[model samples]
Target: MAWFDEVAKFNTPQLRLAHITDCHLFCDIDGEYFAVNTAKHFSSALTHMAQQPLDAVIFGGDLTQDHSFESYLLFAQLIADSPLTCPVFWVPGNHDEISLMQRISGGQIKSAKRLIASGFDILLVNSKGPTPAGWVSEQHINELSEVLAASQQPAVVFCHHNPLPINGYLDKHMLENGPQLLNVLHNSGLVNHLFHGHVHNDYQFKFRSVDILSTPASSVQFTKHSIDWQQQNMGASYRLITLERLNTAEPLCVKSELIWLNE
Candidate 1:
């Protein structure tokens, strides 16, 4: 069965959003991981993101390394200092404490799972588990189904873990119930894109006509196809997604570009 019997049509103007993920920040200003200063890299990424004229910014997850209250404070502070004027949205990752994040954000960082922007519905799903692996609970799946059925607009889903395996050591840590999640999306017939983090590498592919995108970390880029943990010197990167509706009778078209902060 197709995900959509008839696609939602729109003639909306272009909507550009910036996506930053896997910040791995720490309470300490000088925290390091595997010899990489995560805080420094995150600052660099923030500096560059502040320069972009974005409609909104989405953090894909892993906002902190220690999941401490101070870490969340730092995340909020950094955004407050940035030149980004648009609304900010975020989902939780394995390294994040969702309640703590919500408490400290003080409405500045919205935890709403759904957003309507430029004629499209953005669905935020929480795929974080108690352990390093990932799972989507029944509650989220039900909420997603309800939201998709309620909206008559093109949709983009964002989560922390990749629903599809990337075929590396990281595969073991992917969403354990990815097939279930995929089934929900395929049945929704409304989702046009899936954006995720966790893998710490850049990847793009199509599944059932939906764009599946994975972004590199804002701290360290992981070496793909490695049997174990490996790091590359690649600088921080983020994704810029442009959504446009050329006609009122056609499906919304999406263009996503991965921007490297080092450049």
Candidate 2:
């Protein structure tokens, strides 16, 4: 059955995307993270997503817990078996091995830094760092600026680390070069939103005109505003982002929601 048949239709020009992050799947199917079965939750989340009409799926990173080859293989296999057949895009999180992911995905999962679709440009940037923290280098900022300069279409940027501090212990692990990156994004008049994963919580805020959003983990959710590691009872969650193409004189309407799996 078609996924969109049950949902209300919109006449406006729009693009719908599924944003699933921080799966943290281990090599074993029975592996658990903080008492929560990672593989089981991931399967449940994918099953829910299969019912949605998604133009694309974005894995914001932290795709594995043990960072094992087997874990990646399982992730790829699950996606191949699921109802989600759209193009998948991914960036490296602090825990990810980009080369291994690329090899395992067999080029089906594109490591595209920039994607143009439905009147908007999506920019994916690598924020992986030597430590658990993340940093967006000056070179990446320059590349983003160049990409934005090359196109007049509005843009949404994605990374594995939160670009702005969330006022918690996780703040120390946020993007080290956040100020520089934010400056570049704000100066670029075309950037509409910035989406990221790392904190394992759902958060939304604005940095100037650019909306900043963070999604919870597909395996487990972390307690918000805690100085220590704390797990929340919330189940696995993902984000749905829709960008509506408006008239030339009006700005594009960007809407998003956090969908959580009960099971």
Which candidate number maximizes lDDT?
A: 2
Residue-level lDDT of model 1, residues 163-252, one tens digit each, is 888877888889899878877887787777899999999877677767789989988888897888888758888899887765647787
**Which runs of model 2 end up more than 4 angstroms from their true locations?**
1-13
TM-score per candidate: 0.91, 0.91
The lDDT of each candidate is 0.79, 0.80
TM-score of 1: 0.91
The true-structure Cα RMSD of candidate 2 reads 6.1
List the lowest-lDDT window of 10 residues for candidate 2. Answer: 1-10
